[model samples]
Target: MNTQLMPSVSVEDITRAHLRLKGIVLDSPLQYSHRLSEIYGANIYLKREDLQEVRSYKIRGAYNNMSLLSDAQRAQGVVCASAGNHSQGMALACAKMGVRGTIFMPSVTPQQKVKKAKAFGKEFVEVVLVGDTYDDAYAEAIKAAETNGWTFVHPFDDLNTIAGQGTVGLEIYSAANFPIHKVVMAIGGGGLSAGVGSFFKALSPETEIIGVEPKGAPSMYESLRAGKIVNLEKIDSFVDGAAVRQVGKINFPIVQEVVKEVILVPEGQVCATMLDLYNEDGIVAEPAGCLSVAALAKLGDIRGQNIVCVIGGGNNDIARTSEIQERALLWAGLKHYFIVEFPQRAGALRDFLHVLGPDDDITHFEYTKKHNRAVGPALVGIQLSDPATYDDTMKRMAESGFKTRAINKDSTLFEMFI
Candidate 1:
């Protein structure tokens, strides 16, 4: 392993980038959240970067890096790989600078995002969907950039990109009238966290900077723990924006130095937070956007403290709403899946149904296989009106003489049948 120290990014770089982005990027608002404050017993402020032109902070870094490109570099054009947000950012930046851009996105990129990126870039940008993951697309993009002699606009890692992203922290501190004790941000390739963490450490030295990652994809956390960049063999892309195999080499040191702590939140918790943001605040947050907010649940007591949660993006696919709701319910213990084998006798289902509490509702029922005068397995998905009824409901099922296996507890069974 190389123990060499890379060049460090400074507040001067961030301030200079902020000046460059003055009229180009919107100065997104920082608003206080009454509901969140009440729930957490803290003065909660949300930095609404989701409301930016590209509906994410990605534009800041993308445009800043491209704008600084020399005339020859711009003429040769630029190429990048992104799952969604960065692609849109680059497309919009290309249009703004009148530069031709090529974006390589994973085939798994949501339709909503692909369309948005193309729409933003219009004639200035070309979108190519290749590979199943962002890493795959990234490799292809690098090859194309090298072969074509085009500037490869890294989504993160580059000093210019990090400096551009640091402007978010500048905005947070500039617009904040009251003192901010802490600022929480979601970590992907560590661009946002590194940028924001560096800014706070430089300007607001007393303020704590915290980074959060999806529990399924804790690349940053794991990397910091191992004292090097660790590539994850697998990750849950449910939170696509933050699901990175490894943190950027350039950004890792900044994160380790400035970030006080890194926390991992379960994907289900992120889903539930997204739902809460939508229902209570009329805010539609993508899974990654909800990372900072979800960390509030893990913080035991933050009463009377002033904290800022950066909501990163709102590029959520409408098609994922149902899946999000299901995950939220499961996380809340309001939904459960069971494989129940019933005796080969008449009224067996009726008997099983009778055991279910009145508050329990049958959401899904399907027979996995047909049986002739023998016990057969049936899949049952039950939704509880109140989560507290889960224990009693399970007790009733156990006493009903039916062989019931809770699929939620058994990962193998759940993955196979559910």
Candidate 2:
């Protein structure tokens, strides 16, 4: 338990970073959500840090670290690897600072991200897609750092990096005329939470800090429970930006002391928030960015406290937008898929189709031929305006002498295959 590694970053460092970043970064919105305030029983403020220059708060840290580079180091350039937002941040920062930078990213990264990264870097930086995952890309970045002697700009877990991210805390405190009673954020690699938590601890120690994570990627929460950073054997990568297998060595201790709770929100719940923020607030929130706001649905009671939620990043893959919408619909009970096990004898498909009203439509249909025939399973996905239609549909199904079971049902187990 060496506390030396986690030396608390001061509010002074954060304020200084904010001052330095003034002309470089835009002041992202701090919108007051009256609807949210009434619903959550707290005076909620959405610190729209996602609206920053690179469309993420990552730029604050990237710029801070880059600014610290000596004139000599700037000549040689900076290098690091990121999934997307950090690359965007580093690319734009280096370009603006008149420094050369190289970024390595996941090979599976969407073409849009690649295009945007290249757009940000322009001629000032080089973008490379190296490996299937961040860990792989990072290894290559480290090698590049060693060989070229470039200043390796880590996305997190560095003194300069953490100090840079603390600018958010400075912004929060500066924007708050009233003392903030609570603050919430989504934690991925822990840099944002570390920097923000440390700054708040120094400046507003009484404010309760909460961190949220996708339930499928609750690495931080699980690790905190175990009292150490441990690798998860499996992780769901739906929330690609915030899904992490282990906590950062540098950030874990910093957060543990300051954060009051770590909430593991359901993936479906996150999608719901994404849609709500978009539909109600007209805020385009990526999965990772909507996490803290998503926690409001689960947090049943909070009467009159001023709360701030850091909307992290907005580097969403435009192509995945449909899937995000679908997930939201499924979570809202407006979409469902079921495997109807029926006799393979006659016009069963037509009969099932006729049972539905005009509003219900079949979204997917798959029938697997049997080699060792007993019966057949027809995988069907249905979309409807009303979820209650399922009950009536099932009731009619039973009376028609046909059996139906939801793919998600215990006996069906069809959803598990995918």
Candidate 3:
């Protein structure tokens, strides 16, 4: 709890980092979001770091850290661990800086991310697939660096990386034409939040800095509440980029000092935000990228104030779209999965179909045991035109002598059947 134990990162450092990043990383746009503004009742601006060179703001930190490496360090090479974004940034930094680099990624990392990191580094970086979690891969990367005498480029812990990530705040301040009331961003290892929060606190003292985390992986939020760093035993990796088990040691203190509030949003809400951005504004954002905007719904009123939401990355895999839509629909209450026990008679399905309202539609149906003679359970997924109709339809189905068990509330069974 002693702030004196940790070295402070000044606004000067972030300013210098911003200067260092010029012509190297993209000075991403701070554009007004009409759709979001209308939905949230605020003058909403999106800091589009998703459009950065590596499709993330990570390159700013990775490049800054690599650029500052000593000649001997550069010659010795660099190593890092990441699930996706950071690896791509490091690989591209190494390629551009002409330094050899090795990246350790989780074995479960998406194939698209692995391929992009490889393509970015070309011959300069080597990708090593390691254990199942980012923390597992991080430990392996640290060991690899120690064994090879390579300079390890931490994803978020180092002061230089935090300062580099802080450049985002600098750009946001410089680009915003109106007075900014609040800034919102997603937190993983806390590097981006630490950096941006520090810079904004020093420069725009009145602006509130809000940090958001996925509810399933609320390391920073819980840590701040506990007055110390807290490591989670399990995390939901759906928001892979921000699903960190623990916040960075070096960055946590900065977050505690500068960030005013930390909010947690459900993964389903993040998915819904991603879908909205893509469908409404033609913006493609990964789950973590949607976290900032997703928190807007939780904020009560911002009618006259100006708010900035940092869209952190856009490295989403096309293959995850169906799952994302599924989660979004579930969050919106438009979709429900049920296990229905049907009688052995010929009119069983017909009776069940009659229970559905005119707007109710079956999206999925499968007999769990069609060969069973007496009675069999059917896995049925239904979509409602209006979410409000769900309760009424369920009540009608129950009254009609149909036996049904809702699996949507049971995550284990929901995942298994739906």
lDDT of 1: 0.90
Local lDDT at 313 for model 1: 95
TM-score of each model, paired residue for residue: 0.96, 0.90, 0.97
- Per-residue lDDT of candidate 2, residues 289-339 (tens digit): 989999876655678878898898777777887778777777777777776
Q: Taking the tens digit of each residue's C-alpha lDDT, what string does model 3 give over 1-418?
A: 6767975678889888889888878899999998888877789999999898799999988988887899999999999999799999999999888999999999878788899999999999999999878899999999999899999998899999999999999999999878899999999999999999998888888999999999999999999999999999999888989988898999988888899999999998999999989999989999999899999977778898899999999999999999999899998999998998888888989888877889889999998564956788888899999999988988888898878999889989977866
The local lDDT score (0 to 100) that residue 151 gets in candidate 2 is: 89
TM-score of 3: 0.97
Winning model by TM-score = 3
| Winner on TM-score (1 vs 3) | 3
Residue 222 lDDT (model 1): 98
Model 3 misplacement above 4 A: 368-372
Give lDDT per model, in order. 0.90, 0.81, 0.91
Residue 22 in candidate 1, Cα distance off native in Å: 2.2
